[model samples]
Target: MESHTSVVLSLYRHGVTRENQEKIYIGWTDVPVAEEGIDLLMKTKANRPEAERVISSDLKRCVQSADYLFPEEKKIYHKGLREIHFGDWEGKKADELSKRKDFATWLEDPENMRPENGESFEEFSTRIQESWEMIREWCFQDGVKKIAIVSHGGPIRQLLTLLAPAEKPFWEWKPLHGQGITLYWQDAEAFRRGERCTSLSAVPIMEKENG
Candidate 1:
């Protein structure tokens, strides 16, 4: 018998895109996954967990990844799950922005600085928190035991920093393209409270089939 209080949450980063390969800031840009990323995901699909529910960002990259990874599962898309809006920096690389004084200031205190026309880190985190609360409520209502979330690197990292059992900084929780982490919660109370999960494990990865 399944415990109603227990839930498994897997957070998968969308496959890499051309902008990712180019090391550009791609928040809210809506790019498709690259060929290389698709191939890699295809090879690893067998290892991904089967979930009762799948949630995803509405952005093109994450939506495409959910199709590749959870082909049979119906997905709930949320714009709030989207990556932080990079605003003026969208599609630009760090080196290109490095010369700007605003960029340097943002790097030092991103929580307080908003890229001209971009979302401040504080705003982004607040959006994510709301999205997460919604997801938890949905799980409770639907009696979901396992759930998968397909999102961008920034959003996934932010989630892990908040929920992973270990005490890791935001950047330290980075998940590679098409990869994810699984968090196990023994009680729904912790999930509802947005407390850290009791345990966590890396989602298994298999090498590309043709490689």
Candidate 2:
């Protein structure tokens, strides 16, 4: 049998937006990264791995983030990579939703509850799964071994939950804005099987040193 090469995948959350600073839900709202956020994103290249391919959510924040970290690399953008569509909750703070009975119900059982005019947790997961399938095809047909993806918090968390070698709840895998994690698959078969990654590491965007 021929030996198969391994794969490395780096998944990053987009830099912070004004809505994020305000603790508002901005999923699908198309907000750009805040000014200070750009400074932080510029540091992502310091310790991050190089990639043969770069992918990002079509949303403004994610597109800008991928550009910052991999300026010369051509990138592929996809709407399927978007965060959970918050719909009516798109611009509201948690506190603003706190008093709504439906919001409370959704918080308690998000798997089964979706905000009015919004995506259910299952729906969001399904969309991400489709995106994962497309990525797998790229790996198989294109023989891609290294890839980077920049998306929102929710989608990043979902991808980690799906690929992390260790069992961790969705919330436990949180990557702050401008931060991310790298996942490794031992071989093409392992990746195709949808098995957990063989190992993982953090991809932190650290501060630059004083000149």
Candidate 3:
């Protein structure tokens, strides 16, 4: 077999919004960055990596953050990298949904019972994985080895959960807003197989002296 080709992905969670500040489950909601999140997002810029290209979720928050972080790089807007659609719960805070049994069920088994009209974990993972394959294929064919992805927490979490060295659940690998993680894939095929690659230490947005 041919030796595996490597690729580096610098994945970032987009800046926050007023809904995020209000502790709302802000998924599939097109809103701009909030006042408080401005400073947090700026910190991410200081930790920027040299990327061959930029890809962003089509959501306003990610698109705006991508432009701010990488003003010169070409941005490819893709909806496949969007946050999991919250559907009826798009704007509801966690506290507001704490009493709903469906919420509890979703927490335990998201693949079985999802939010009303929202995507199940299975569906979300499938689409994201497919999109990821396409992105990697495009990059590999173009002689690209590194790229930056500006996206939401949900998609970033999936990448982490799938790429983590040890097995973990969704909530266990939560990435903060504007925070990120770098994935070192064994090869492009690893992404398609959903196989774990080398373990990368989590990349925090505001942490200093990350050596």
Candidate 4:
């Protein structure tokens, strides 16, 4: 929320977790990133611009990644930035639920309903919207012109709905592990009036660790 232009929002996803390597639905699972992921994050930290401040989800993977990237900076963590809660499906693999009727329905149309006691799409998006408003306020108050956010894919995708609506639907915006987009706005007025990102660009992930 700078006077000259909007803040540079560098949104980054957490690195690979064991569940991620296993291709599991890791919604709000609280798992740490693997060692390989840590190494990748350390390397990738060198690729991006220096951030004025850092924010992260309270989850383990995101917290760790933020600590690594901005060790000396004051890091803020909030639960609102966490991934969608899958409820009973928290740790299940995609293939494991491939045949379930609800899974198919949930996958086919995630916006209209919830997933087995999990948060509905509305719930998820609403939290993200509220969190983003809070984050923007923080930036405006602190005069923070550049910010970095480390979070999970679900929140990133949900936030993208506000940041880059034309990008794709939630599921279609499946950002890779340790990858996210940098969204730019014009100013506080544009941000408040709900303007889309002036530039929507992906931060490429490093080559996958040799498994």
The candidate scoring highest on lDDT is 2
In candidate 2, the residue pairs with backbone N, CA or C atoms under 3 Å apart (3 or more residues apart, or in different chains) clash, namely none
Model 4, span 120-175: residue lDDT tens: 88898899999999887777777787788999888887788668837677777877
**Regarding TM-score, does 1 or 4 come out ahead?**
1
After superposition on all C-alphas, the RMSD of every candidate to the true structure, in Å, is: 1.9, 1.6, 3.6, 3.1
- Candidate 1 lDDT, tens digit per residue, 1-211? 1344787899988988999999889899989999988977776577887799999999999999999999998998999999999899998998999999999999998878999899989899999988998888878767787899999888888888888887898877769898878899998766766789999988888775573
In terms of lDDT, the poorest run of 10 residues in model 3 is 202-211
RMSD of 3: 3.6
Tens digit of per-residue lDDT, candidate 2, span 2-94? 128888899988989989999898889988999978887888777889899999999999999999989999999999999999889889999
lDDT of each: 0.87, 0.88, 0.79, 0.81
Q: Clash number for every model?
A: 0, 0, 0, 0
**Model 1, global lDDT:** 0.87
Candidate 1 at residue 161, lDDT? 82
TM-score-based ranking: 2, 1, 4, 3
What TM-score does candidate 1 get on C-alpha atoms? 0.93
TM-score of each: 0.93, 0.95, 0.85, 0.88
**lDDT tens per residue, model 3, 102-163:** 89888777767889878777888888888887887677668676788999887888877766
